[model samples]
Target: MRLAFNNFISIYQGLSREIWVLSVVSLINRIGAMVIPFLSIYLADAKGFTLAEIGWVMSSFGVGSLIGSWLGGKLTDKFGFYPIIIFSLFTSGIGLILLKELDTFYEICGGFFLVTLFTDILRPPIFVAIRQYSSEKNRTKSITLIRLAINLGFSAGPATGGLLIATWGYTSLFWVDGVSCILALLIFVLAIQPKKKIVEENDDSLEENKKSQSPYRDFPYLLFILSMVFFGVIFMQYFSTVPLFYKEVHELNEAVIGLLLSSNGFVIFLLEMPLIHWVEKQKKYSTMQIMMSSIVLVLLSYILLIVGHDLWVLFIGMMLLTLGEMLMFPLSNAEAMSRASGKYQGDYMALYTIAFSISHLVGHNLGMQSVNIFGYNYTWTFMIAGLLLCIVLLQLFQFSKKREELSQTAK
Candidate 1:
């Protein structure tokens, strides 16, 4: 127990200022920004819309998120991080307020698109900017804290939103979320100043003033983006498809569904850091490799849900799924940050976020349609198989083909 306590203490000591600020921002964003804007409940309870209409509304959010993620990266590059972050938070607050007043479907859709756009737009900039304060030596720990903070916020935020909706109604949730976002903006405005690149004694003079290149011109960043698509599909399902699965098949009550969702956070808070050390310990057990393996496992949760329809079993399955997700967040983040060019860190991270956002926006319904049209079993089987195939490809694909081509030419 003492040894374990000491290990955790040392880990905490290693955390950088950037990671700390990110965690605080993430905590506020999750808790405050989601307090209102209940898509399904509002559509059903307030508007008397059908399940299909709600799906469309949710899709609007996805569409907005995809565009926002791409734009956030570019905006960060053009305007710099602090300005873009502040501007997006303010813009998103307006979008939330629009949700409070808008009633008609078209108007609501417009608000949804804008709100989704600005809300998700803030994410990649937050992620990329954190890298300025960290190096390769500590990047994994930095990402781990960021993920933990996000989950921490989610753990508290939705419950608060639920309570606000219960007592005051849906609009209250929006106000709280918006206010929370503003609070994060204030904190960021006060504390974080951008780092300076001061010249060092041993640094090369020729390289000092060299023109900065964007990650779009960097091939390795692009390659990592391609690898992320498979992983994104697995992550997108939780927000997009899993709810329908639980409703249609598991027949879980609202409380159980809440537990299942929160369990994802619980798993990460409990397991991810411990597992981080194990993954880092072996040369072959890279953070990326572990993340790839975990994503395949996450896909398998759908399989068990489809096969058995048992609540306890599904809960256990999701624990495993969360375990997989826990791996991806830190591992892939570290991998991407390492690969980015210094001049284009914001743009690169934003582009990376775009891949995740597009997968959610474009692919969420596609995957959900599987469970809706085909039986649950078929859907789970197909998605899980696809994820496993991705894991295999990620492991074998990175550098082998390029080296093989060169060797063939030499022969």
Candidate 2:
């Protein structure tokens, strides 16, 4: 036991300081942001908003994300990841704090929009650093750890919020989010004081480090971004539609609902690192196909949830969602980074993050309008159609595998 423990410590010790810093930075950043899952409930229960108003308010963050993603990616390409991350974290803190004070619907929604925008705007830069800090040896592993931290934060944040809001009220929830974010920002500034600025490193002809010389040279990277964003609508449904279903069908209370929804995170925390490491050790192309397959399976689970709302059925569906997420996040990230030049790791990662960011916006905007017109059950139908559409896109991309292989010479 001690020998295994010591070896694990040794492996961790050998990771680059930048890698560790980025990992911890991701962990802290996610922990700070995790307070949001219950924001809809908080507004509905404590703020006295109607369902229609709450739906629009629920989407403020997505609206901000839509505007931020492309701009944020461009900023990372122009200035650097460090500046963007530091600025976004602090702004997220301020936004959360202000969310506590707003009373009117417009004021609250407007504040939430900026909060979501500023907070998520940092995603491109954060992901840029993550891909930058990986090696072939640990590329997928490192990102998986980062994803694990996110899920871990997800596991705790809303469950904790449920308890806190149940006793202390909702404004206090944003205050807690604000304080934690401020602390995260402080940690990022202190722990990751980058010794030098971001410039295209001259030396990276390494196996996984071939990078784009300029953002304009990133067309394939941009294609991968389109693929990622296309599927994001399916993923976003877990946050928006699934929660609504739990409330409407199960009639579950805040804490119980939080616990059920959070079980996915629990599954992720226990199993993801080993699973990612194992999957990446396989042939890379096949590995991604498997990950993509998992996503299809996850989408199918939503179909199941849409059909059945019983507790056990929901448990099975949630389990599928968690497992599929454990595979999807890291592998997709690594694959996206793999296609780019060494110098444009940040640029490539930013595009990938842009896909996710835009998905939130597109999904929610569609979701809000769809719910008003067709009702909530068909929201899952839209999600299913989006997932199936992406599956078709995957098929289209798979046929180009030979082209991808032929282009590997570019590295």
TM-score of each: 0.86, 0.80
lDDT tens readout by residue for model 2, 211-310: 4355455444444566678777678777776677678777877787777776877777767876765675577558657866877888878788778857
Q: lDDT (0-100) at residue 164 of candidate 2?
A: 78
After the best TM-score superposition of candidate 2, give how far the Cα of residue 176 lies from its true spot, in angstroms.
2.7
lDDT of 1 by residue, 18-52 (tens): 67987898888887856333668878898888888
- Tell me the lDDT of model 1 at 28: 86
Alpha-carbon RMSD, each predicted model: 4.1, 4.2
Highest lDDT scorer: 1
Off-target runs (Cα >4 Å) in candidate 1 are: 1-3, 35-37, 50-52, 198-220, 238-252, 299-312, 400-411
Best candidate per TM-score, number? 1
Query: lDDT score of model 2?
Result: 0.71
User: Alpha carbon lDDT of residue 161, candidate 2?
Assistant: 77
